[model samples]
Target: MMKITVALLFGGKSTEHEVSLQSAKNIINAIDKEKYELTLIGIDKRGQWFLCDQEDFLINGDSPKDIMLKHKGLAVAFQMGKDSEQLICFAEKTFTKSIDVVFPILHGTYGEDGTVQGLLTLANIPFVGPSPLGSGIGMDKDVAKRLLRDAGIPVAKSLTYHQWEQPGINFEAVVEQLGLPVFVKPASLGSSVGISKVKQQDELFAAIKEAFAFDHKIIIEECIEGQEIECAILGNEIPIASAVGAIIPQQEFYSYAAKYIDDQGAAIQIPADIPKEIAALVQELAIKAFQVLCCEGMARVDFFLTKEHNVLINEINTIPGFTKISMYPKLWGISGISYTDLIDRLIQLALERNIKDKSIRKSY
Candidate 1:
């Protein structure tokens, strides 16, 4: 059997760039070497792509923090050919090689928000994760909530405001509707990067400003008091949802620090201590959200479960974090799928979708 040449793309011009590095490191370690000939491609903060080496990290087993995307001699790039994909390495000149598939581990913005997926779609290459349309909607909180609401999914009441529209009046009226202790977040980001928990009217404007710093559009959500839960979904047409997981955040919310940097962080309960019916509902909703959003390979659907047992869809993460301790993989692990096997399945799903896509005719 021929080893598949896989390009593992990571890092990007996003605030979550460092987190992406950590995620890519975990992915590189878990991918089966016998099945894939993996090449490391790093996109720096400036959005420049460079060829990176995985030898040091693989051989020494370095910590995720130590695993930086050091630029190698040549720059790596991808392009679409008539019938195949080309991953060319450039130095003085250039050399091209065929890439069988791409496993992008980049987490936010330029990487996960459909920018790379659109490129891969144009190249007609098999890649792990959702299609460009799915990725775009998944990354945008405003668009996603609207779609879910239309589909009869329960979503929290929220308001969207662009940075330019901040000057408009009616702050008091807005607070009156949503109530106090709202969530202010950037419309298109993850890992709680540009998010703030505003408990008072005085905190509202500052929180909005903070979120707008990361995205042109900012969203304020009415705080739903309940347990934070997440469900992992995999596959294409008939995706499988893992057992629900509960999050007990040490901080006010699941902030960036609690997720990654802090040691005490959050206590994640696998097979969340919810009723059987609620778990079943979450599983069903997870698949429904995945299908409605057009997610193909994988996604992690998060929810807020109220005391009265009402499950409200918070958001969906198309390419969620994959660090060794991340909830997405950990939840699946408890569901009896090993980390390595989960990665294998995602790659297989990518190829499966690619074959189906190729069957369609462009002219017809």
Candidate 2:
């Protein structure tokens, strides 16, 4: 059998660029070499796209841009249309390569926030993770919370504001409404970048300012004191939710450092110590959130298990981390799916979506 051509897209122009690099490295190592022909595409911090060398993918000692420039990596571009769509990789204004599948390992902002998803959709490319609609809403905490609440999923109390409203924002009113110990973060970005746990009234203004620096919109939510439970869901139409896992953070919360940088940041408890009923509830709720949000391929639904045993939906990651130590694969691993097989599963889901979507009529 001929090997499928896989384009592993990574290193996006997002706050989590470094995180994406690490994720792509892990994914590249896990993918079966015999089944797929891999093409590494790296999008640098400045938004420059390059066809990276496979050997250089895991080498974080050098910047992607510098490595790309030195290795004469191809510059990539997308041409849109039903038939005219193509991923054109140009090197020295001559070389070009055809792409079959795109595994966008990009996280946060332009990556997970629907920008790249929209681009891929228009180009008629089969890519992993959620559709543009799902990605757009899922990336924004404010919008997602509203939608979740409307869907009958319990969410924490929160307020959304734009940077322009900073001058008029009544910090005292915000504190009074959400109470102390509020979490401030950019509404759209992920990987815990520009997130702050505001415990005092004095920290409100600064936290909001810091969050707004990451995105124009910001969300301030009441910090729930509870166990952080995460459930990984895989598949397209019929998503399979893995056993619920819990996070015990050594830090104040699961920040970027805790997630990617620090080694002893968090303790993962797979098949969490929670009651069996709660575990089943988490899986059910996760599947519901995935379907309601139009998520395809896979998603990781996070929740807050309150002291009172209430399950409050935190947020859904349409494209959760795939790094060796990432919860998505780790949870599924404990649930009996190997890392390599999990990658194959997502690729299959992406192809299934492509087939189903292609069947739809473009015109009456």
TM-score of each model, in listed order: 0.96, 0.95
Top candidate by lDDT: 1
Q: What tens-digit string does per-residue lDDT give for candidate 2 at 137-173?
A: 8898888998888999999999889988989888789
Among the numbered candidates, top TM-score falls to 1
Q: Model 2 reaches what TM-score against the true structure? A: 0.95
Model 2 weakest 10-residue run by lDDT: 61-70
Summarize candidate 1's per-residue lDDT along 262-297 as a digit string, tens digits: 647899899899999999999999899999887889
Count: clashes, candidate 2: 0
Cα displacement (angstroms), candidate 2, residue 3, comes to: 0.6
- Model 1 residue pairs with clashes: none
Candidate 2 Cα misplacement greater than 4 A, ranges: 61-72, 82-85
Candidate 1 at residue 301, lDDT? 99
Question: Any residue pairs clashing in model 2, and if so which?
Answer: none
138: Cα error in model 1, Å: 0.5
